[model samples]
Structure formats: structure tokens, C-alpha cells
Target: MKKRKIFFVTGARSEYDIMHPVLEQLQDSGEIDLQLVVTGAHLSETFGKTVRNIERDGFKIADRIYNLLSTEDKVGRIAGLGSQVTALAHTFNREKPDIIVVVGDREEAISVSLTAAYLSIPVAHLAGGDIANDGNIDNSVRYAATKFAHIHFTFLEQHAQVLKMLGEDEYRIFNTGNPALDKFIHCPRMEKKAVQPLIEFNIQDEPYIVLIQHPIITEVENAGDQIKETLEAVIASGLKCFVNYPNSDAGNFAIIENINAYATKYPDVFHLFKNLDRVNYINLLRYASCLIGNSSSGILEAPSIGLPVVNIGSRQRDRYSAGNVIYTGYDREEITAAIKKSVFDEKYRAEVKAIRNPYGNGDSASRISDVLKTIALDDKLIYKNITYKVF
Candidate 1:
């Protein structure tokens, strides 16, 4: 049998982590020729040189393209996406792989998905049908990726149903949960000796919180004000706040700067980790007083571990949540109040710990790999007809 060529695209650190298992599986498979196309923050000098992380994980790079914006602004983001689409169209046509596998909702993936769809490549999208952030652009991009994609791995069965209702053929959408879940199933319990040196802290001595909030790229003007209000609330909450690095997006420069400045002023209460491996981040959440902010992981991943989450603002306005989550508006008082409750309210903490996650039971990689193996590759790709019935 002739080997079918598969081109997997990686745009962000987290996406790379989620897809790592599939990459390895495909590498070992005799029937699939895996070609990895890496771009976006990986190609950029900033963002910890993401490509290094990929290489360290033992994947050979087939193609490397740069689509980083010159400035972190609206104009820069638009220019960068346009750059990605143009470059990816050229590369995808050159490789002409049998499948284009995409994951998550970064703008880089959006650009690459458009390029693949135009070139009529069979796209396999992972983690579709979930919603998060009014201004994050993920909801629209994820929905758009689903239509062009020939295969999908939603985080749950209901999400798969939603995709089918959106006109996707039931066969094309699979309920594999989020591949990110695979990371948890393999997580080695962190020892104090190993973790203490990994993060610089007064953390072992007192309570600490893990926070991740990216720019609401869809809304440019509120970036600074939103971070400011959130910072004020974090400080007022009276707990040691450990903020992680934000994603590289337009308006993120200001947010990063503000966080750094805030850290310098209140070194004891404010802690910042420039980068964390996914395992460390998970372990930290396990011990954190509360996981706060708009990161999708807080909503989807934290609940599985029964971690308390204080989700804020319009950033995560539409995502599904479990009992572990407590939301608040962008108001500083509300944010502060929510944080205080997560730390001090005994009943609320107990309730959060008892809620089970609706996301997955951790077999996403195998399920996703199976779907890719079975999908039909046709010459003409179009949306399949859906059967709707009157109730």
C-alpha cells in the first residue's frame, strides 16, 4: 500500500503540546508520511523561540515560515495573518499533502486553515465547537475551521452534536474530547524537591494563584484598562498572585509591560512566571488557591481536577463551564470579591472540588488518530448535506 502523506501544522506552544502524541503516532505509522509545517510564534524570536520547544520534543521540521507581526497592534495582527495565508498557500501547494491537520484557535491556524481550504486539502480540526472570549476571535475561527475541516475532534459529545447541527456530516465530526487531556493522564506527580527549583517563590511558604489572561484582540481600546482593573483586583484580593506569560497578540505588549511593572511594585504579593511547561502549570493549578482569568484551560481543564476558578469579564463570555467556575464582570470589586471567595469560602471550595468536568475522560489522542485513519479523501470538497427533522 502507498503511504498517504499527512501535513500537520503547529502554531502555538499549547497546540504543539496537544498534538505531540498524534505526531509521534503518525511518525511510527507505516501508512502515513508526516510532514510538519511550523509557523507563527514558533518562527518569531520572541515567545521563547517556540520552534526550539518542538525540536526538543523530537519532531523534525518539514517547513519553517515566519508570520510574526512587527508591532503588537491591530494593524500588525492583520498584516501577520495576511502574511501567513500567503506563505502557507505557497507551501501547502508545494507539499500537497493528503491531509492538513489543525488544532486550536490561534490566528496562525486561521490563516493556515484558509490556505488549506482554498487549496482543497482535507483539513482535520481538533478541539472544535467550544466557545470562549468575546474578543478572542477563537469562537468565529473555530466555527469557520469546522466547516472547511473534513474531520473534527470536539472536547465532548454535545460539541460534536453542535457541529453536526451546523451542517457538518455526522461522520466528519468525532467526540474525541480535547487532546490536551492526554497530558493530564500522563502527568507525573510533582515532587517538592523538583518543583521548588522550577519556580522561584515564597510560594511553598504561603498561598499562590496561577493566572493567565491574554489580550482581547478583538477589542483594541480596552486592553490596557482591562488589565489595569484585573491587576487592581488581583492586588486587592490579598493573596499571592502568580501570573504566567501571555500569548503573543496585538495589544499584548502593553499588558506584559503593565504586569512586569506591577510585579516590581509588589514583589511579595505579585509573582510572575515568564514561562511554564504544561505539566508544571497543571501541578501549580492543583495547589493554587484559585485559577483565575479567561484562559480556556481554566474553564475546560481545571474542572476535571476540581480546581477553583475565578473567570472574569467578557473574555470568556461564551465557553462552557462546570461547578468549579465562578464568573464575574470586569469590575474590580467583583473580580476581587470572586477571588476572595475562592480562597476563603469553605463551602464554595468544597463545591468546586466536587464538580466533574464535562470535557473528557482522557482518550482524545487515540480517538483523533482513528478518525484520521478512516476519513475519505475526495477530489472535490464541499459541505455535506445534513438531515433535519420537524419535531
Candidate 2:
């Protein structure tokens, strides 16, 4: 029997974190050949050189296409997509795989999916049908990928409904939950003693909040002001804050500059990191008083750990909200109050503790693998038939 080959393309640490389990499952099956393509922020030194994390996990990368640009502006993003399209076209032509698996709505994923569509290769997209109303380019890019994709794996039923409404065949859409949860559900929490040596600062006896705020592409100009507001709130709260750098987006330079200035001014209160291994990151979330940020990690993963989240701004605006998440505007007072409520309000804390993660069960990777094992790779599957409805 011929081994089925699936090319999995990952661009950033966040997407790679979720794709790890599914990659492992496919490799372990002994029936599927996993061709891993590493690109985007993973290769950049500024982003913690997270490709090292993949290597440490003992997976061989089939290719490392240099698709990311040093510039993070509007023009740079368009150039980056062009580079990815050219690189991926060559990659698919040279190493023909039966299927292409892409997750999320990042530029890399959208580029790869669009390239595959032109190449007539079947593209399977994960985490589709979610909404981000913050005017992030990802929303429109995500829908475009869904339209081109042959299969869709959504984390929630609502997302699946949205996908169907967008004209994807219901039979080809699978609600496999969020694969990012698989690691959190299966991996044991890192010991505090072990985690201490991994991070730059020691964990305080007092509770701390894990903060990860990124620039909203649409509101790129306000990125600095937003970070400043969040920084002031963290300082005023008098709580120890463990913060990660913002992602490589249009206005990231402003966010990075603000982070650097904060670390210089409040060295003791804020512990900054470029990246933390998945286990240690989850461990931080597990022990944090509350997860504070506009990051999807707070909305998707924190609730599963029974952590309260103070989600700032509209970056994650229409993604499903758990009772654990307190949405606030990007004002210093609003952010500070949200943190205080997340930490000291007993009634709110109780509500958060009782909330369930709407994402999924722990077995999402296995379900995705099962679908891959049996999915037929043929003209019938590669060619998408748009479902039309008269509403």
C-alpha cells in the first residue's frame, strides 16, 4: 500500500502550537507521510526562532521557505504573500502531496491555500468560519480560503454553520474542535521549579497575570497608545505581569518599542518573553490569576484551564466568548478595572470557573487524522462544488 502524503504548512508559533499534535498523530499512523513546511515568524530570530521548537520535538522539516519580510508594513505584507505564493507553487510542483493542510487565517495559510487552489491540489483548512470583526485582514482572507478549500475543520458548531452558509458542502465540513486544546488536555503541567529556570524571572509568591496583546492590523496606528494603556493598567494593578511580545504584524514595531520601554522602566513587575515552549506557556496560564490580552489564547485556551481572562479591545471581537472573558475598551481605567474584577471579584470569578470552553474535547487531532486517513484524493474531492441556497 502506498503511503498517503499530506503537506502541512505552518507560518507562526501560534498555528504551529495547535498543529503539533495532528502532525504527531499522522506520523505515528505509519500510513501517512507528513511533509512539514516551516516558514513565517518561526524562522525569525525576533520571534524566538520557534522553528527550533519544532526541531526539538524531533520532526524533520521538509522545507523552510523564506517567505517573511523584515518589514511589517502594508506593502511588506503584500510582498510576503507574493513570495509565499511563488515558493509554494514551486514546492507543490516539486513535491506533489495528496493534500495540503492549512490552519487559521494568517497570510501564510491564505497564500498557501490560494496557491494550492491554482495548482489543483486539495486544500484542507482548519479553524475556518470564525469571525474577527476588528477589521483585521484575516477575516476576509479566511473566508476566501474557505471558498477555495476542499475540506473545512471548524472548532465549534457555530463556525460550521457559518461555513455552510458560505457555500461549502456540509458533507466536507467537520467540527473537529480546536487542535490547540489537545496539548493542554494531554500534557502534564510543568513543575514550578522546572518552569522557574526556563523563564527570565522567578515566579512570585503573589499571583500574576499572563499578558499577550497584539496590534490590530486595522488599528495599526493606535498600536502604541493601546500598549501604553495596557502597560499602565498592569502597573497600577500592582500585580506581577508575565508578558509576551506582540506578533509580526503591520504595527508591531510600535508594540515592540512599548514593550522594550516597559521592561526598562518596570523591570521587576513585568517579565517579558519572546517565546515560551508550549508546556511552560500552558503552565503559566495554569497558574496565572487571570489571562489578560486581545490574544485568542485567552479566548480559546485559558477557559479550559479555568482561568479568568480580561480581553482588551476588539481584536478578537466576534470569536465566541466564554463566561471567563471580560471584554473591555483600550482605556487604562477599563483595563485596570477588568483585571481587578477578574482577580478579586468573587462572583465574577465563580462565573468564570464554572464556564466551559466552547472549542472542543481533547481528541481533535485524532479526529482530524482519521478524516485524513480515509479521505479520497481524486478529482471529485479536489474540485469544490459551491452549495447554493435560496434564503
Candidate 3:
């Protein structure tokens, strides 16, 4: 049989790290021909010029869609989606790929995957049926992406079951584990000192907290206030706080401004980072006292390494979690209490350390690739029955 041609679409700070191994194996192995497409933050200037990072890591980008929205407002976001879909439609026609692979539920990923779906290309949707950030399009994006795609490649077995409950074809859905966890399990925990240079920190001596908040798309106006509460909580707790930048959402600039101002006043207390490439991120993540964020990493990536997470607010509101997570409102006191308890409580820390990740082991990339090769490519691939939601 001839090799299958798989095209991958990624946008703005989704877990590109998760796909690293999958892409590498597909490219290196003779069975699959890979065509990678980069859009979203990969092409944005305000987002650390991240596209260069994609190329620096060594993968072929077949399409570079240029649509950088200034304000993180719904209008700009929707417009950008319109532009991206148009550009990728051209790319798909030229590439004529056998299958399209999209990861996560970011707006850009949804747009690209939708483009592929409209063109009648089979899509392999990863990280569907997970929950987080109530206002975030993540839940809607993931679920909607699931509707358009053929294969469901979820990060957790529980998530796969949820997809089946949501009416996805059980035969087509496979629990490949999270691609992000693959990096965590495969690589040695990066010594805190080894990653110290990435941040201008004296973190080699003691523990620290990592902040990774994304702008709430639904409440774009109050983002500055929410970010203030997050910062105040970190400062009030007196924990060594490492601030990771937010994603390129409508109100992302406000979050950036808050981080910049926070960096200036706190000095050593703040471990400033532009952005971390995936491996260094997972490595350092293992050592953080606790992750303070509304991002999905807390629910999905942190637990695999037995890392503790203090998830704040509606961002990750109703998500599944490992035993290591502590949920609290975004109020400074609530955030502070959660952080202090998760980090300083020795007995609790030991309990968290003993808990294993409920998500799968490290064979996700391989298993996902195995199914991509074997699944039939026909109308039956695209057509699926909607299983009734059990009340």
C-alpha cells in the first residue's frame, strides 16, 4: 500500500510539543508522508515571533497564513478565523493530503480543522471532550471540532468515553493519551539549575510557582482586573512567582501589560520568562511548587508528573483533574489560600506526590499514528451517528 499523506494544522500556543514526537516519527518513518501547516501565533509578531521557533525545531511548514488580529476582541478573532480558513483552503487544495491532524481546541485549530472538514478531508482531532475555562471556546471548539472530524484521538481514556457519550463513533475514537504527557514521561526531569538560564532566576536554590493565565474570551473587558487578582495573590502569598505569558486572545495585551508591570516592581520575586519551548516547560513544570493558572496545562499536563496545580476561576471551572489540583475562585484571598496550602503544606504535598496521573502512559503518538494508517478512507469515515446524551 502507498504511504498516507497527513497534514497537520496548529495555531497560536496550542500544545505543539505534544505533536513533536508524532511528527518526527511520521516524517522519519517510510509509511507516512508529512505536510505541516503553521498559522495563528506561529505567524504573530506580538506572540514572541513564535513561528521562528517552529522552524528552528525542524519541521516543514507548508502554509504560513498571515492574519494577526490586534485586539483580542470577538470581531478580530472571528475575522482572523475567516482569513485563516481562506488561506488554508488554498493550501489543502494544493497539498491534497490523505488525512488532516489537528490538536487541541484553540480558535485557530478549530478554524483550520473546519477548513479541512469542508474540503472533505478526514480529520484526526486530539484533546477533545476535555473541559476548561468556561468562557473559552476550548469546550465549544473541541466539541465542534469533534463534530467535523472523523477520528477522535483524546488525551485521556475518560475523555474518549465522554466523546462517545457526546455521540462520537466509539470505533473511531481512540485514547492515545495526551501528546504533552509523552514529553514528560520520556525526558529526564530537567534539573531546576539546568533551566535557570531560561529565566533570570536564582530558582536553583528553592521552589517556585508558575503563572499561565489566558484571557477570558467571554469577559474581555475585565481581564486586567482578573490578572491583577492573580498577581496580588502571588505577591501576597510570598511565593517565588514565575509568570508565563498568556495566549493571543482578544484581551491578551492587557495581560501582557500586567505581567510587564509586575516584573518591574517585584524583581527577584518574579521569575520572568518570554515563553518556554515545550521540553524545557515540561522539565521545569515537574519542579514548580504549584502551577497558578486557568490554562489546560494544570488539568492535563501537570498531573502526569505529579505536579501540584492551584487552578483559579471559571477558566478551568468544571474540568477533570488529578489528585494534585486545588480549585478556587479568582479572588486574591482564595487564590492565595490555595497556593499557600498546595505549596507549603507538607502532608498535603506528600499526598499529592503519591498520586499517579489518571491519563494514559507514553505511547500516544505511536498509537495515534497506528490508527491513522489503518482506518478506512471513505464516506463511512466522515459519517457518524450522534449518540444520545444520557441524562
Best by TM-score: 2
Candidate 3 wrongly placed segments (more than 4 Å): 384-391
| Clashing residue pairs in candidate 2 (N, C-alpha, C atoms within 3 angstroms) | none
TM-score for each of the candidates = 0.92, 0.97, 0.94
How would you encode candidate 3's per-residue C-alpha lDDT over 217-265 as one tens digit per residue?
7878988888999999998998788888888877788889998898898
lDDT of each: 0.78, 0.87, 0.80
Best by lDDT: 2
Model 2 over residues 233-303: C-alpha lDDT tens digits? 99999998998988888888898998899989999988889999888898878878898888899878887
* Candidate 1 structure quality by residue, lDDT tens digits, 115-219: 887777888888887766575677788888776677787887878878877877776777877777667656777865567577777667667677888887766
The better-scoring model by TM-score among 1 and 2 is 2
Query: Where's the lowest-lDDT run of ten residues in candidate 1?
Result: 379-388
Pick out the ten consecutive residues of candidate 3 with the lowest summed lDDT: 12-21
